[model samples]
Target chain A: LAKTTQPISMDSYEGQEVNITCSHNNIATNDYITWYQQFPSQGPRFIIQGYKTKVTNEVASLFIPADRKSSTLSLPRVSLSDTAVYYCLIGGATNKLIFGTGTLLAVQP
Target chain B: SQTIHQWPATLVQPVGSPLSLECTVEGTSNPNLYWYRQAAGRGLQLLFYSVGIGQISSEVPQNLSASRPQDRQFILSSKKLLLSDSGFYLCAWSLGRVEEKLFFGSGTQLSVL
Candidate 1:
């Protein structure tokens, strides 16, 4: 499984955009980058996923560079309700899915 | 319209006691089910996974054991609980073939005192 590295925490204001980047230098060719949003006391929810380039969904957008070594999760128009821990995971099946300490985005008023 | 359900939202068990956690999926058949544990301020650890009924694969060898009694039901059990077992346990399901996005259920929070 590929290990991901992300910032410990980030602060964003309401109505502003937030971008959390994850680095997976050893990402496999068949690996897909997936981002999940986890609120305290509940299960994590799938936000977006992408193999390469960029993919957008109703909730968020994922931008993957050509190398695929790193991907960025962009959240547009942040709100207080959006404040939660965001996890970036790589290599879903070939190896067991491992979660790393994610970027804790605190949306401020 | 698939949904996963996990029970015992919160559990407090004493050391050396028995433990059982149940997870069930509706609207999907023969899905891959998994058991994961999340520690405080840490990431999720894959404890067990099952591809089919009576088929189980364990990622970490420890006090916990998982069983898939039916196509859509998975259970986590322990003969004797340990204080170290306190954490958030999550159950998830995905398509059986290969790399599919996993759908998670409401997790169970276990506190062993």
Candidate 2:
């Protein structure tokens, strides 16, 4: 399983865009980058996933570089309710998906 | 549409007592099931996973054990609970593969005193 490193916490104001980057220097060729959002006392919710390039969904966008060593999760127009812990994972069917200490995004009014 | 049911929502048990947490999935069959533990202010730790009925894989060596008796039922149990077992337990299932996008339950808050 590839380990991921992310910022411990980030601060952003409402209506602003937030980007959380994750570093997975040991990412494998078959690995896919996936991001999840977790609120207090709840299970993490899948936000976006991408193998390479950019993939956009209604909730968030995932950007993966050509090297696949790093990925970014971009949240547009943040709101107070959007505050949560964000996790970036790199794995495939053969690997175990491990959740690291995620980036806690604080959306302040 | 599929849903996972896990209970009891919150449990307070004394150390040395037996523990059982049941999770059942509806609207799906033969889904891959997993049990994860999350300590306060920590990341999720995969405890066990099952690919099919009666086939379970333990991820970490601990006091907890898991069983898959039916196609959609996963159970987490411990003969004697330890204080270290106290944490938020989450049950999740995926469509076909273990690494696929997972659908998780509400989770059980376990407190071993």
Candidate 3:
């Protein structure tokens, strides 16, 4: 499994765009970048996923550079409801994941 | 549309007691099921996964075991519970698609004393 590193915590105010980056220097070609949001007591919810370049949805966007060694999760117009733990995961052929401690984003009103 | 159901919502068990947690998925067929544990203020730990009925793969070895009696039913069991077993247990399911997202149950909070 490829290990991922992310910030422990980040802060943002309402109406701001928040970008969280994850570093997976040893990512493989088959690995796809996926992001998930987790609330305090709930299970993780998928935000977005991308193979390369950029992929955007109503909730968030995923940017994977050509090198694929790192990926960024971009959230626009942040709100207090968006405050949660964001996890960057590498999904591949095996469909297995090794989750590291995720980045906690605290959105202020 | 798929939904996952996990029970007891909350449980309290004494150390050395046996444990059982059940999970089921609906509105989908032949989906892959998973069991995960999350400690307070921590990330999730994948405990078990099932690809099909009666097939289970465990990520870590401890006092826990899993059984998939039916295609959509996954169960986590323990012969003797330890204090370390206290945590939030979650059940999830995903499409067989390699890149698909996982849909999770509400969750179960297990307290071992």
Candidate 4:
């Protein structure tokens, strides 16, 4: 499992774009950068994933540079409902998943 | 579409009592099942995982034990609960390949008094 490092907390206003970056310096060649969002009292929800370069979904976008050591999760036009803890996981196609202390994004009104 | 189910949504148990939490998956076969515990104000810790029925791999060994009686059913149990065992338990299932995305259940909040 590739350990990830992210900010403990971040504050953003509604309607603004938010980007949370995660560092996984030991990322493997086959590892993929995946992000998950978790609201209080609810399970974590999958947001987006990328192996390299950029991958975009209707919900969010993931950017991975050539080094694969770090990645960014971008949420466009955020709202109060997007306030949650965001987790970044790096793993290969055959490894057990491990989650670390996620970045808590607080969307202010 | 694969879905995961876990119960009971919330549990309040006295110390020394036995504990059993169940998790099941639907719409997928031979999926990898995992049990994770998230302590209040903490990150998720992997407890156990199963690659197939009747096979379990323990990640953090403690008073807890896991069983997989069926391909889709995974159970987390304890002979006697401890105060430290109290936390939010989440059940998730993933495809055989890693990073393929995991589907999580609603999760159970256990409060040991």
Model number with the top TM-score: 4
Tens digits of per-residue lDDT, candidate 4, A1-109, equal: 6789999999999999999999999888788888999998888999999999999999999999999999999999999999999999887555478897999999999
DockQ of each: 0.56, 0.58, 0.72, 0.70
lDDT of 2 at B33: 90
- Tens digits of lDDT, candidate 3, B1-113: 77899998999999999999999999999998999999988899999988899989899899999999999999999999999999999999988686857888989999999
Number of the candidate with higher TM-score, 1 or 3: 3
- For model 2, residues B1-113, the per-residue Cα lDDT tens digits are 89999999999999999999999999987888989999999989989988899999899998889999999999999999999999999998877643468788999999999
Error of 1 at A71 (Å): 0.2
List the candidate numbers ranked by TM-score, top first.
Answer: 4, 3, 2, 1
Give the C-alpha miss distance for residue B27 in model 2, angstroms.
1.5
Report lDDT (Cα) of residue A1, candidate 1. Answer: 66
For candidate 4, lDDT tens digit of each residue in B1-113? Answer: 77788999999999999999999899989988999999999998999988899989999989999999999999999999999999999999988684568789999999988
Query: Model 1: which residue pairs collide?
Result: none
Model 2 residue B113 CA deviation (Å) reads 1.1
Order the candidates by DockQ, highest first. Answer: 3, 4, 2, 1
Least lDDT summed over 10 consecutive residues: which range in candidate 3 chain B? B95-104
Higher-scoring candidate on DockQ, 2 or 3: 3
Better model by DockQ: candidate 1 vs candidate 2: 2
Candidate 3 stretches with Cα past 4 Å from truth are: none
Write candidate 2's Cα lDDT for A1-109 as tens digits.
6889999999999999999999999987777788988997898888988889999999888988889899999999999999999999777745366787899999999
